[model samples]
Target: MLNEHAKLLALFKQTGEIIGRKKLQKMVYIAKKMNLPFNEKYQLHMFGPYSEELSLRVEEVCQLQFVSEVKEKKGGYQQYRYELSEKGEDFLSMMSFHFPDATGMLEDMNHKSSKFLELVSTVLYFEELPKKEVAEKVFKLKAKQNYSEADLDEAYAYINRLHQVAPKKGAYS
Candidate 1:
């Protein structure tokens, strides 16, 4: 099994772009829900589903110069964006063979907006709900986000498609 840092590095490599902390958290949570062996514990937090383990791993990688963190001013507040450093990229390339499914999952998530990822991850977090009930349940759970039934449907569809293609291999399968 790959370590959390390796999984995060693979994410950066697959995306090939800078990612915000919240987006990175959601992406990893989604991958976990899909049974990609991320092994991070997720809980509902300020943004939706959050993984503190992943956050710490990101910090470690930054400290190791495996990833670069840039502080950017957005709307008068500072936002940290992360991208894999050259060393991180080299490490990810070396470790890629051990995590083919994880790499594929990250590739699937590439180009998705944070909002979309948040909605989908939130929906998947409540996976016990019946298919027909998912939209209603997500609508209620994310009331502050004002997600409509249509939005729920779209997010559910995306999650469902991902599962169909990826087909998680463990207990969730």
Candidate 2:
């Protein structure tokens, strides 16, 4: 359980500061799908794959001062920015954590808009199905997003690029 927390800490260690709770969630979910070792349980939610376990772990880490969560106003609603506290860095240094070199993949993800990540993760959530089926599901479930074949194609191609970038622990990379 706390081991998972350590991994989250490692993510901050790698990515510096990650903005938005939703981005963090999608980043972890995407990394897990890429065959990295995250064990958060997710359900399909309004945005995409949401992990309550991941959420609680983040909260606990914040309470423990391992991570910092700051709320900021983005347009109409509130947004959260997460970063590794000094305590988090200290704790992570003590753990013998072996993880993929996801720095490139994570930085790539961090550069993307949350909406694009949303579409990417939603595509990944139903990845077990055929491409046609996944596209159909995205069309059905994410009609509000106004995704086109171009978007779906971009998402699929982006998945390949992400897999290649994660490094080691190969499934499809």
Per TM-score, the best of the predicted structures is 2
lDDT of 1 by residue, 1-173 (tens): 34667877866777666557777888878877777657878888867899877788888999989999998889978888888899987777777355544556576686688888988988887788786687776666777888877887888789878887764477432
Whole-model lDDT values for every prediction:
0.77, 0.87
lDDT of 2 at 8: 87
Cα RMSD to the true fold for all candidates? 2.9, 2.3
| Model 2: per-residue Cα lDDT over 1-173, one tens digit each | 46888988987877889999888999999988877789899999999999999999999999999999999998999999999999988898888767666787888888888888899999999988999999889989988989899988998999999877665665322
- Pairs that clash in candidate 2: none
By summed lDDT, the worst window of 10 consecutive residues in model 1 runs over 96-105
**What residue runs in model 2 are displaced by over 4 Å at the alpha carbon?**
168-173
Displacement of the residue 20 alpha carbon in candidate 2, Å: 0.9
